[model samples]
Target chain A: MKEKLCSLQEAVATYVHDGDVVAIGGVGRNRAPMALVREVIRQGKKNLHIVGREKGMEFDMLIGAGCVKKVSFALVSLEEFGLAMNFRRKAQAGEIELDEHACNSVITSLRAASMGLPFLPLRGMFGSGVFEVSKNLKEIECPFTGERLAAVRAIKPNVTLIHAHQADKYGNVRIMGSPFEDILKAWAAEKTIVTVEEIIDNDEIRNNPQLTSIPYIYIDAVVHQPKGAWPASCDSYYDSDIEEIKAYAQAIKSPEGFQEYLEQRVLSRRD
Target chain B: MAEYTTAELMAVCLAREISDGDRVLQGLYSPLPMMACLLAKRFHAPNMTYFNTADVIDPEPKKVPFSTAGPALQERAVTYIPLWQTFDLAQRGELDLIFLGAAQVDKHGNTNLSAIGPYEKPKVRLPGGAASAHLCAIMDTVIWIPRHNNRVLVEKVDFITGQGYLSGGDAREKAGIPKGGPRKVVTNLCIMDFEPETKAMRLVSLHPGVSLEQVKEATGFELIIPSEVKETEPPSPEELEFMREIDPKGVRELEFH
Candidate 1:
């Protein structure tokens, strides 16, 4: 049994390497592993490929920090607040490659990887132009039905980071509500790092084994960091820091503003 | 004549479209549709199953949260679904009605939530298509646009996220899509539905104070208008009170603003 427990800084330093395709788990402002994401930015890791379903704060921060080179996911907006300014600006500036997929397609790729399959067939991308752009997606005929369907190649990330409500000493991770691709992402990645708001007793995890979203067998590292999903809602813990997200959305509108934001918020926060 | 904001009116009109025991789906950042789902449950469709994009299935939250992913929305959810399951159900054709918003909607009802310009060099990189491509291919889609204008309602979308009728007739079926497609498009100004013959979006009814001329001007392409277009009825006092009760914080006002 490997001792999976560690600090957020150590976990990011050890597992997340440069140019690694890292998947951060969350939907919108929910359960985003922002602490580890900020540490990744602070470490100056470059050319990282990021994957998420509905990426918001984590991806946007990484993109703004110039840490990400490519992104494969659907819809990177702040939901209601507006578009992800950094992601939008950097993507448009050609600074980063945007391999956009339907939200389902992103999950399909993850699900394929998790299932240990070469590719997964789906009918979702049949008519959409996504098939035309996505190099990994090809149109193939179903053997039985002979119907044309989209076959997406498995996307196995080098490492994945997920935020959860609690985890035990042995890293049985439990997410309070709406796992939101974290479990699937963990299963799909080569290495999975979990950041938790609290680290409970192993006995507590054992008593309710079914409640555990990710078992210790899958999780590589468990980082105990309270408010790990700061600014993003942590479900049953605290509400999203909307004012900060809103300010970040507003300030990231310009190059200078974005720079100031990165310096003041991400870079300066050594704690 | 009663006074109600366009958001409330849209909610009321959308609620009317949902029937009893119909399973409804709403996407992220959809406050109006979320309200409509709640209203339908309270009034006509109590047995209806409602699911939000955030994976909150049959949520019975006290107040509608700012985002579907918010904690409030998950206050008393029947179950939690992953993003994968949401699409899985759609593919299996389990979901009946879906409420979606689009950046641009075409005459044929094809939607664009992808980008404003070409894929390579976009003038505006709008949020890329989520599950709209799949949901639109399978289930009955109800599009609600808070802002109605020529730019929003185009002759042809820059890109098709959710396939409406494609090129009309059996185009969707020809593309190997499932039976259902865009059923209605409720906007601030009017409610539009696809013509049975051509699948072109037709002006079904104008909102109160919204003229047919105004709708035509706002629409990018020529619309199929009935000779006798009726005005959308204002939300009744009871309906308004129910809505206000459902949303005490006036969160719906944010969308209109």
Candidate 2:
């Protein structure tokens, strides 16, 4: 088996490129691959197309750092802290292209990619204003039932980034709780880079193979980074750092403050 | 009558929407619905299958977490159901109830959580609606607007993130939605329901101390007020106590602010 373990900087630099389509792991503030995301920003990658369902700070920070030019997502918010200010500001200013979708459509699109299909039929979003702005969605009649369904175009991201609780050197990953679309994302993307809290022995992974969420076949690189999902909870590892998130939210209220935040928190960090 | 905060009253009203065996799902940033679900399960709807954005099934959290998607919800769950599977349940017409917050709501019941001004160039890009489009068509959607004002209760939304009665009577049906749409809209001031004939938002009941003139003044669009409007029942002592028991830190009040 090929040893897929590498440093975070090398993994991101080699796989993630300028203007590549990227899908981030985690939902909201849970198990976000912050370390990998920060590295992508740190490397000064630009014009990347980000895709996800119900993203939060991960997507917001990327947009804040000006790394993203377009986003195809269902929702992006900081939950209780309020709207993702950076996303709201950039979007309001028409700085980023929005391929806004309903959450179901995003899921169906990823599913289509995972299945190697051109598109998948969705049941809802017919009269929704989201159906109006979504350029990739089309109305198709089911051949058998003659039912009108929304056909969501498949989204195959160039690289998928994920954070897992544990993994082996060969990249058999075990996500502790709520593997929110991470598995589907890995299967849909051309390459997948997982940052893990710890890299365990391959024998241990093989001992309990059923616990492995994503097998070595799907993963391209595995970067062992402790506290990879910092500020976000890792489920059974640590709770979300609400104060830090709140402070970050406050810091990004202005464009100058957002840049200052990047300098102090994200850009200043060493790999 | 028992003394209660507006948040407590809203939570109790939302809790009453659940039946014994309804399969309900709560979304992210929904502290009020989270409290309501716990209160319902503990009281009337013990058999209802509760699900959250965290993918936990029938979670028995000791206390409501600050974030609705927190790990506390996963602590004592019966099992796990990924979001796709939950969406599948809604598509299959098995999921009964869901609560969604709206940035703006029209008289036709169409909600906009997308953008305030226009799609191409928005004045304020609100948080995109998560699963509202799909689930609002299939599940019995209960919308909550914490701040009831002219800005929120618009005559027509700029964008329809969630399909309600789409331009009124039979429009939702013509759109080929499988089943279910907006059932009841609970706000801080009053409870509103759709008029059966016109599918327009109609004032049903007002919360205690909230006047008919106040609701009329707050709504941007003309509401179909019936000949008589009832006052919303205040939270009972038992309900208020149970609400405190579930959310002692008053997380339910977070959205109201």
Candidate 3:
């Protein structure tokens, strides 16, 4: 196997391209690939179509930085702090395209891509207005039972970005807790780039093979960055830096403030 | 009656709804419901299976974490169930109850967490509904609206992010939904349930100090008052003590603030 270890900048630069459909791995406020996301912002990648299940700071920051042209998501918000100001602002202003989906639809779509299917049958969202607005979903009657089902189109992203607890140089990853759709995203995407908190020996990963969430075959690149998911919890590693998150939430209230946030928090960082 | 915050009162009321052996799930940004589930597990419904947005199954966290979607929930968790699997459980009909938050809710309990005005050009682009659309259709949903006013309680939602009774009477069934819809709506001011035939929101009970006139004034649509609306029970002293023990930092009050 080719050694996939590389720097965050190189991994993002090489794998993530302009206008590529990028899948974000983590769920809300936990294990987001922030270091990789910041590099994507700093590199000035544009017009990316972002996808995620339940997103938070990473998606909001990407939108605020004007890197995203369209977003396909079930939900994106700052949770307790408030609404994702940038997303709310840009969406209401019609600056970005919103392909709204229910959470299950996104999962089912990704699952379809993972399984190499054109579309997958889903149980719900038939009567809700979300079903009406979602252009990718179709209602189909099951042939065997004549039961109604929503068919969600497969979403095969060009790249999937993930943050995990540990990995080997060859890209065998160990996600400590709650591998929230990261493995599915990896399988669904053409290329998977992982940013891990630590790089361990291959023997350590080999010793406990069952702990390896994403094997080397699926991962295209592995970026080793400690505290990569700062302001977002990494399970056993550390708790979320709520103070910094609050600071970020406070800073992005205005356009100028958002730029300043990008400069000081995102762009200025060297890792 | 013991002195209790509205948050505490709401938590107790929500806990009362959980029955033994019921499989309950709570999504992100939901401290009150989290507290209620924990409270229920500790008190009445020990056999109830609990799930959170953090993907931890039956977590016994020390205290309610500031962010519901974080590592704190993983502490002493029985097992891990990722978002997909949890939704799968709902699809398989194993999930008994779900607590969902709404941005705007209508008389029929149709929720709008999608947008305020229009799909393309929204007046206000609220957070898109995560699993509300799917779960509300498949399983029992207990909606919690932190703020109760004319703006939130509407005649018709601008968009239905979650299907409730749809247009009322046989609408959900006609739409091919097999089971489950919004069961009850719990708000800061009062508790509301759907009328059996019309499926419109009806006044169930008023919270301790809130009045019938106040509820009528706050609601955007005319509510079906049942002539005798009882005052919602205040949180018991034992309940208050246990709630304080669970949430020493008052994390549950953050939503109210």
| TM-scores of chain B, in order | 0.95, 0.98, 0.98
- TM-scores of all candidate predictions against the true structure: 0.97, 0.98, 0.99
Q: After superposition, how far is residue A193 of candidate 2 from its true place, in Å?
A: 0.8
The DockQ of each candidate is 0.70, 0.82, 0.88
Candidate 3 lDDT by residue in tens digits, A113-198? 99999999999887898898788998999999999999999999999999999999999999999998999999999999999999
Who is ahead in DockQ, 2 or 3? 3
Off by over 4 Å in 2: none
Inter-residue clash pairs, candidate 1: none
True contacts kept of each: 0.66, 0.77, 0.90
Q: What 10-residue stretch in candidate 1 chain A is worst by lDDT?
A: A123-132
Lowest summed lDDT window (length 10), candidate 3 chain B: B62-71
Task: Give per-residue CA lDDT, model 1, range B71-116, as digits (tens).
Answer: 8887788888876787787788777898888999999988888788
Please name the candidate that would achieve the greatest DockQ relative to the true structure.
3
**Candidate 2, residue B3: lDDT:** 84
**CAPRI accuracy category, model 3:** high
Residues A1-271, candidate 2: write the lDDT tens digits.
7999999999999999999999999989998999999999999999999999999999999999999999999899999887799999999888999998988889889999999999998888889888866889999999999989889999999999999999999989999899989999999999999999988999898889989999999999999999999998898899899999998888888889889989989899874
Would you list the clashing residue pairs of candidate 3? Answer: none
Clash counts per candidate, in order, are: 0, 0, 0
lDDT of each: 0.86, 0.91, 0.91
Write model 3 residue lDDT over B1-257, tens digit each, in one string: 67888898889888888999999998888898899999899888999988998898999988778888778888899888887898999999999999898889999999999899877788999999999888888989999988999999999999999999999998999998859988899999999999999999999999988989999999999999998999899888888888898689898998898
